[model samples]
Target: MGRWVLVAVAPAELVLIALLAAGVEVPAGVRATLGLLMIAVLLVEAGRWSRGYRRGRRRGLGRRAAATVAAAELVPPPVTTALRWEARVWTGLVRGLGRRPDIPPGAAAFTHHRAMRAVRWTFVGVLVVEVAAVHLLVPAGALRVTLLLVGLYSLVWVVGYVLGAGPVRPHLVTADRVVLRCGLTTRIEVPLAALADARPVRRSRDRTASRQLAGRTLHLVDNGGTSLDLDLRSAVTVPLPRGRSAEVDALRVWVDDAQAMARQVRAAAGIGPGAPAELPPGR
Candidate 1:
C-alpha cells in the first residue's frame, strides 16, 4: 500500500517541484491537495517503518541493521541506502574539516588517500570551472537558476567525495580484526583468525567503481588500482550498498603503503616469520 502511494505520488511531486523551479505557476488548490496527500503518505509510511523497526529489534538485529530493515519494508532498500549515502557525504564534508582519521586505540591506520588525492582535487577543480562557466554563460531566468544550482550541488558532491576518501575513512588493523574501508560508504571487516595470507601486489584496471566484487573476491580500488591482496581462511560476509552482501574469500585493496600494511597485518596476525610480539598502537 505504501509502495503504491509512493509510486503514484512521487512522480507528481517531482513534477510539481520542477515546475516551481522553472517558474511555472501552479494553482494553489492543486498544490495544497498534493501537499496534503504527500504528508499523509509520509505519516503512513512512518508508522509502518516504526513497527517494522521494533520487530527487527525484537529479532536481535543491531540498531543500524534494524533501521535498514524497517526502511526496506516501507520503500526499496536501494532508495534508502542511496539517501543515507548522500547524507553521509554531506556530513563527511564537515567532518573532513577536522582532518581526523577514524582510528581507534590499539589499532593501526593505513591510509589510501595519497593515491587518489591528485585525481580528486583535479576533478574538483574541473567542477569549479564548469560551475563558473555555466553561471557566466547562462542567461538570467529559471533555466539559468536551475543549472547554477545543479552545478553548485555537483561541486559539493565532488568535495564530499574527496573528503570521504581521505581522513573521514581509512583502513584499520586491530588486534582481532582488519577493517577495510572505501570512503564513508563501504566497510569490510575480517577477523584475524580468518586471515590466511597477506601479500603486496599491484592490479590496475580501467574502472571507476570504488568497490567491486567478482566471484568470491572483493576489490576496493583507489586511483584505478589495488596494491594489496588478502586471502581469507574461509568465506566471510562483506556488506555492499543497497543492503546487499557477498561471501568473500579474498580481497584486493589500495593503500599508500601496501608493503608496510602487509607487514603489519602479517605481524599482527602471526601469519609469516618474525611476527611482532604485540600489536602496535594506532598511527
Candidate 2:
C-alpha cells in the first residue's frame, strides 16, 4: 500500500518541483495540497518501514541487515538501484581520487587493460566543451542553469568511470571467489568452487555491448572486446541494472593481463594444468 502510494505521488512531486525550478508559477492551493499529500504519504511509509525494520530485528537480523531488508521491501527496486548506483559513483570518485583499489586481504588484483583510455578521455573532453558552450552561449535562466548542472554531473561520472575502471577497482581473484567488475556499473562474483575452466580468448571489436547476455553466456566487454572467459559448473545469477538478473553458465571479461588472470584463477580453483576443460556451448 505504501509502495503504491509512493510510486503514484513521487512522480507528481518531481514534476511539480521541476516546474517550479523552471520558473513556472503554480497556484498556491494546488501546491499546498500536493505538499500535504506528500507529507502524509511519507509519514505512513515511514511507519510501515519502521515496523518492517522491527520485524527483521525480531527475527535476529543485525541492525544494518534489518535496515537494508526493510528498505528493499518498502522502496521500489528501481529507486533503490538508482540510489545504489549513485552512491557507488560518488564513492568511486573519492576512492579514485585517493588512488586506492578495493582489494580485500589475501586477494590478487588484476587491472583491466587501458583499452578504453582514448575513448574515455575523448568523451570527457567533449563533455567539458559542451558544458563550456552551455555556460557561454545559453542565456542566463533556470533552464540554462539546469543544463549546466547536468553537464557537470556527467563530467563527474566520467572521471569516476576513468578512475574506477582503472587501478582503483580491478578484477580480483580471492581465495574463495573471482570478483569481476566494470567500473561502478556491473559486478560479478563467482565462487572458486563453481569455476569449471578459465582461458584467454579474443573477442571481436565490433561487438560493442559493455554487458551482453547470449544464451547462457554473460559478456563483460571493455573497449568493445573481451580477453578472458570463465566457464562455471552451472548457471549462477548475475545481477543487472534496473533490478534485473540473468542466470549465466559462462562469463567473458577483459583484463590487463589475461594470461595472468587465467593462471591465477586456475591455480586458486585447484585446477591442474591437465584438467579437462568443460567449456560452455558457443555463443
Candidate 3:
C-alpha cells in the first residue's frame, strides 16, 4: 500500500528530487515550470478522487445501497440521497431502452450505472453534433467523408456504453461467488469455496496497483482507492482487460461497505472473524 501510494505521487517526487540535485545548474524558469506541472498533476488527481467520492455518495439511497457503502461518510446523507436519485435515473433509462439484464437470484448489484450516464449522454451528444456537422458544415468532399466516419464512431461509442453498462448481470454478490464487471470487457469472479479471507481497505489508500492493473482487477469502484482486499486460498482464473485471462490469488477491489462485504465473505466461507486478512503492505 505504501509503495502504491508512493507510486501515485512518484512523478512529482522524482521531479523534486531531481530539482534538488540540480540546484544552481538548472534554470530557475525550468524549475518553476516543473514545480507547476507537478502541482497541476497532483491537483488533477486530487480532484478526481474527490469527484469519485461525490459519485459514490450519489449512487444509492439506503445505507446498505451499493453507492452509500463506500461513500456513506464522504457527503451529507441528504446529498448522498440526491446522488442516489441521479443514479436511479440512469438505471431507469437503461430499463426503458431495452430489456434489463437478469440479475443473479438472491444477490445484490454494486454499480456506477448512474455515474456512467454522463458518458453515455456525452457520446449521444457527440454523435448528434458530428452527424449534423457532416451534413451542415461539409458538403460533398473528403472532409464530409471524414466527418461521417467520425460521426459513426461517436455512435459506436454510445452503443458500446449502452450495451456494456445496461446489463445487470455483471455486478452480483451472491452466496457463492462475487462477480464484478467493468464496462463490457473486464469481469472477475471470486467463489466462496476458493476463498480465504476478506479485509476492509481504507479509502485513503493509494491505487497505484489498481491503476496499473486497471480493468483486470475486480474493481467496482468509482474512486480508484482500495476499499476491499481478498486473499485467495489458491490462484483463480479471471479475465483481464484485453480479452485475456490471468491466474491471480491476490485481488483488490473498490466497493461499498467493504467491512460488511468482508464480514459476509468470511461468514459464508467459514473463515474465522477478527483474523488479519489485509494484503501485505506495499505489495
Global lDDT of each candidate:
0.84, 0.84, 0.60
Inter-residue clash pairs, candidate 2:
113-256
Model 3 — TM-score against the truth?
0.48
TM-score, candidate 1, is 0.79
If scored against the real structure, what TM-score would every candidate get?
0.79, 0.81, 0.48
Clashes of each: 0, 1, 4
Query: Which candidate number maximizes TM-score?
Result: 2
Ranking by TM-score: 2, 1, 3
Give, for candidate 3, the lowest lDDT window spanning 10 residues: 208-217
lDDT of 2 by residue, 150-232 (tens): 89999998787677667678999998999998757677889998898998898865667677887778888786789998988
- lDDT string for model 1 (9-43, tens) is 98899889998878899999999999999999988
Residue ranges of candidate 2 with Cα displaced over 4 Å: 7-25, 62-64, 183-185, 232-237, 240-249, 270-283
Provide the clash count, candidate 2. Answer: 1
Residues 1-283 of candidate 3 have per-residue lDDT tens digits of 3223334455555756654654525667766776676676656656655565566657644434544343343344455545554554456346546766647668766543553466667878877876887778777755566567767765755554565554443456788887766544356778887777878775543443332344334444544465677777766887654345667766776655667777777777778886654444443
**Candidate 1 or 2, higher TM-score?**
2
